[model samples]
Target: MYQLKESRKLSNTEMKECLQISKSEFLEQINLECSGCISALKDFITLNRKDQFISIDQDIKLNDDLINSQRIFKTFAKLQSFGESIKSIISSIFKKTAPQNNKKRCQLHSLKQNPEINIQEHVHYICNEIVNQNEDCIIQDKEFDYHLQNYLKTKKFCPSCKENIQAALKHFKLQVPQPDCACSIICFIKYDHLKCEIHIPYDPILLNALLNKAQIQPFYQHASTKEDAQEELLICIGLLIKDRLSSLYRETQTQEIIKYIFYQQIGEIFKRRLENYSKMKGEHKSQLEELEQYLKKEVEQKDKQKKKRQLKKQKRKEQQLSFDGSVRANYLQESSRRSISPSNSEKNLLKSFGWQGSPSVSPQTRKELEFLQKEHLQEINNRRKQLREQTKQCWCEWCHHHKQK
Candidate 1:
C-alpha cells in the first residue's frame, strides 16, 4: 500500500510500471483466474492511498480475491461516469444494483437512451466547410452574420440584393419592395425575386406592418456624394417648377392654365411639397406683418404718453418757481414801505419845529434803505431773466404764457 501511495506521485511512465508490478503481485497472491481485475486493484489502491498509506496487512484480513473484486467494481463505476460510450454499461449496473423504484428505473433508462447530446455539432457542421476552404474563413463568417443581423434590424437590403430587385422590377414590371418594408434578411433569402404583374403597386397595410416589425421608416435621400448629384439636381428643378406654377396660379384666375400647371406638377411630388411649404411661409409672413403693425402702434402710443408726462412735470416746476418769485417780491415791497414811511413823518416834524436836522434820517437807516432797494431791484431782474430762460426751454402751459408776453 505504501508503494502504491508512492507510485501515485510518479510520472505517467513510472506510475504505469509500478501499477504493472502491483497487478502481477496481486494476481499471484489471489490464486484466482486473473480476470484483469488486478489491474483495477492496483489503480484503486494507488488512488485511495495517494495522501496516506493504508496498513492493508494489519487493518483488513481480506482475501486477495475479495480485494480484487472490490477494486473491479470501483473501476467500472469510474469508467461509467466518464466514458462517452459507457451508458449501456452503467444502465446494466443500475438495473442489477439500484432500488426497484419506478422513478429510478426511468432515470436509468433515460441516461442509457440519450447519452450526452453535443450542442456544438450544428455550429461546427455549418462552419466546417468554409473553415477548410479559406484560411480566414472564421472571420468572414462572423462579419457576414453581423451584417446580416444589422440588415434584419434596419430593413435595408444589401447592395447586391437591392440591385437585383431593382433590375427585376424594372424589366419584368414587378413591384419593388417599398423602402420601409424591405427586410434584407427575409427578402434576400425569400423574396428578392418575388413576382407581381403590376408596376410599382402600393401596398400600404402590408408595407407598414413589415416596417413596424423591422423598426424602420422611409428615409429621405441625402445628397452627400457625386452619386447623389443627379437626384439633388432633379429636386432643385422640381422646386423651380413648383415656384413658377404657384406664381402663375396666384397671378392668373384662368381655370385652363391652372389645370395644365397642376397636371405638370403632379409628376414631381417633391415640387408639390415645396409649393405647400412656400404657402405656409407666406401665411407666416402675413401674421408677422400684423404683429409688426401692432407693435409699431403700441410704441407710438407710449412715446406720446411719455411726452405728455414730461410736459405736465415741466408745468408744475414752472408754477412753483413763479409762486416763489412773487412771494419774494411782495415781502420786499412791504419791508421798503415800512422803512420809508417812518422816516417821512420824522422829517416833517423836524421841519415844522424849525430844527435843523440832517434830513431826520440816521446814516444806518439810509444805508439800510439803499441796500433794500438794491436787493429788490436785483431780485426783480433775476426773476424776469429766469422766466425768459424757462419760456425758451419749456413746453408747458405756464411757460407758454410767459413766452407770449
Candidate 2:
C-alpha cells in the first residue's frame, strides 16, 4: 500500500531515478503487483499450514467459531472465496483446455490467434496473394490450412520475432511474467487465410483483484473523460497480454507469438467487414430486383388497359360503320321509290285526263291533274325534311366532318 502511494505521487522517470533502476525494471515492478499479491497469499497459506490446507491439494475444512473469533482467519477465508470466484469467472470466459493436455488439435484451437507465419513480410505477402488470387484456385489449394496448424505446434521461428515482441512489450509499458507464475499458455500461429483460431492465452489477473482498495491502485488515478477511459482500458489490456505472454511463451518465441496475435486481429476485423459488406450487397440486389418486378407489372397493367381502350374504339368504329351503311341504304331506297313514283304518277295523271283518245281536255280533268301534282310535290318535300333532320343528329366524327363540309 505504501509503495502504491509512492507510485501515485511520483512520475515513471522519478520512480526509476529514485529506485536506481531502469525504465524496464520500473515497469516490470509496477505491472506485477497482482502477481506479488498472489505470492504473498501463498506464503501466508504456507505459514498457516498448521491450521488447515486451503489449496486444491486437499479438501478445505471450515470451523465457524475459528472464522468468527479470529479476524485474520476470517479475512483469509474471504480472500480465498474471492479468489475462487475469480478463477470460476476466468474458466468460464476462456473455456478451452490448456495446451499441456495434448487434446485433439481442433479442440484446442482458438479463432482469435491462429496464424500461418509469424514473420510480418511473409504474412503480408500471403494476404496480398489471397486478395489477388482467383476464388476458384484459392478454394482448391488446401496448403494454407496445413501451414496454419504448423505455426501453432512448430518450435521453429523467424530470428527477428523475439525482437519484435520485446519492442511491443516496451511500447505497451508491459513485461512478460516469470515462467513459474504463468497461469495460461498461448501458441501464436501466423497464416494468411483459414478459420481464425489464434490461441490467445487467458490471463489469470482479475480486474476486481487489481481494483481492490487493499491491493494495487487503479491503472489511472482519474479517467475523467471518454478518451481517458479508453486509454485506461487499453493500458489494462496491454498489462493482461504482457502477463500472458511472459508466462506462456519462451523468450525466443515471444516475438512470433506477438506478431501472430497482431496479424490475427487484423484478419478477424477484415473478415467481419467483408461479411457486413456482402450482406449489404445482397440487400441492395434484392431491392433492385423488387423494383424491376414492380415496374414490369406496372407496364403489363398499362398494356392491358391500352388494349382495352383500343378494342372499345374499334368496336365503336364497327358500330358506326354499320349504322352509316343502314342510313345510306335507307336513303337510296327512298330516292329510288321517289323516282319510280314520279313516273307512275305521270302515267296515272295521263290515264285520269283521258288524253289517250281525245286531244282536247275538259276543265275538270285539268283541275284534277293540278291537285295530284301538288299532292305529290308535298309528299316529296316532307320526306326531304325528315332526311335532313336525321343527318343533323349524327354525332360520329366521320359523319360530323362530312356534315360540316
Clash totals for all candidate models: 0, 16
What lDDT does each candidate get? 0.38, 0.39
Work out how many backbone clashes candidate 2 has. 16
For candidate 1, write residues 211-304 as lDDT tens digits.
Answer: 2333323364333343333233222222332233233322231222222222222212222223344455556778999999999999999999
Model 1, position 159, has a per-residue lDDT of: 56
lDDT of 2 by residue, 297-349 (tens): 99999999999999999999999999999989977665545432224565566
lDDT of 1 at 60: 14
**Model 2 alpha-carbon drift over 4 Å, by segment:** 1-261, 338-405
Q: Report residue 347 deviation for candidate 2 (angstroms).
A: 22
Error of 2 at 174 (Å): 38
Cα RMSD to native, each candidate?
44.9, 32.0
Candidate 1 clashing pairs, residues 3+ apart or interchain: none
